[model samples]
Target: TQLLEQSPQFLSIQEGENLTVYCNSSSVFSSLQWYRQEPGEGPVLLVTVVTGGEVKKLKRLTFQFGDARKDSSLHITAAQPGDTGLYLCAGGGGGATNKLIFGTGTLLAVQP
Candidate 1:
């Protein structure tokens, strides 16, 4: 089975800090998605990068997919208290299931 592992399961920082989270896997995926979730709510899509070596940016967040499609990264710049949430990376397989395999997640706390 394919699996995604995330690093620094927890993070705390002062407002306006910067951080990077990594998602890795041994299996290649057709597409990968990044989602940010707040407490007691479902995750909202941040971005989806499909092509290998693809890079997408949203505000202070930057997402990159590895050339091998087996890994991805999320970089946050000048993070604010509003950025505090659970970050997740999901991979989409090419099979008929087309289900998303989610990472363990990273809980970020940005202090004001």
Candidate 2:
């Protein structure tokens, strides 16, 4: 079983500041995904990266998959209070089940 781990488990920053979160694993995955969740809500998919060394952007946020497909990172620019939430990284999709291995999670608090 693959275990995904995220860095900076908790982050608190003021508005307009930038931050980066990392996800790592020792196993290679066919794909990786990022998600954000709010209190009492399920996580919402933010982006999915299927190729090694691929990078994707969503507004002020950027997501990158590692060249080895075992790591990923999320970067938010000029973070806003609205960006406050729980960030998660999931990896897997190598088999028919397509189950995902989720990371420990990162809780970000962007204060205005």
Candidate 3:
């Protein structure tokens, strides 16, 4: 599978803590998306960022795209146990196949 390269691949935090996860690539993407995956289900799309330097907020989470469309980051504030999951970023390039290159991922575990 294609990987987008993520940083801080594993994270262990207490409930109500804050964390930031990063996804990066040498090549620029047409768009980038973030997803949250639980243990037994398919990945759930969180947000899509198409423009450079754009930022979107969802409740306690914030998403940002790099200026050149080559990277993205996700920040979660006051995380809870319910937020524990595998967070992934998928970079969509302007290739013919339109394949989504996913990040290596950040496995977040929020302890109670």
Candidate 4:
């Protein structure tokens, strides 16, 4: 089993604004991943951070992993209405099962 913590449990922003979400943990894992989830259906994997201090960007989204591999962050540039949803961070054991320990998560609401 694994555990994670997220900050600013809730965020509300206007379209074209910028925001950031963070995930932190005391435990280390082989890999860390970010997902954007809407209601009903399963979460969609946004990106994965394996090495410490790794940084990746997807369009207006930027993801960063902590140097110690114990934390991660997601930054959104010029947020849009479609960006409204639940953002989650999950950790992997680097094993064969692809098992995940999910973070409590942060909720983002972008109002147009």
Give candidate 1 misplaced runs (Cα > 4 Å): none
Model 4 lowest lDDT segment of ten:
1-10
lDDT of candidate model 4 versus the reference: 0.93
Q: Give the per-residue lDDT digits (tens) of candidate 4, residues 1-112.
A: 4679998899999999999899999988889999999999799999999999999999999999999889999999999999999999999867788899999989999999
Q: Give the TM-score of candidate 2.
A: 0.98
Report the CA-based lDDT of candidate 3 relative to the real structure.
0.93
TM-score per candidate:
0.98, 0.98, 0.95, 0.94
Task: Return whichever of 1 and 3 wins on lDDT.
Answer: 1
Residue 68 displacement (Å), model 1: 0.4
Candidate RMSDs in order = 0.6, 0.6, 1.5, 1.2
Residue 50 in model 2: lDDT: 98
Q: List the residue pairs that clash in candidate 1.
A: none
Off by over 4 Å in 4: 95-97
| Candidate 1's TM-score | 0.98
Assess each prediction's global lDDT (C-alpha) against the native.
Answer: 0.96, 0.97, 0.93, 0.93
Model 2 lDDT tens row, 31-88: 9999999999999999999999999999999999999999999999999999999999
Q: After superposition, how far is residue 17 of candidate 3 from its true place, in Å?
A: 0.9
C-alpha positional error of residue 91 in candidate 2 after TM-score superposition, expressed in Å: 0.6
Which regions of candidate 3 fall more than 4 Å away from where they truly are?
1-3
Model 1 Cα RMSD, Å?
0.6
Clashes of each: 0, 0, 0, 0
Q: Write the per-residue lDDT of candidate 3 for residues 2-112, one digit (tens) a residue.
A: 458998989999998999999988888999999999999999999999999999999999999999999899999999999999999999887698888888989999999
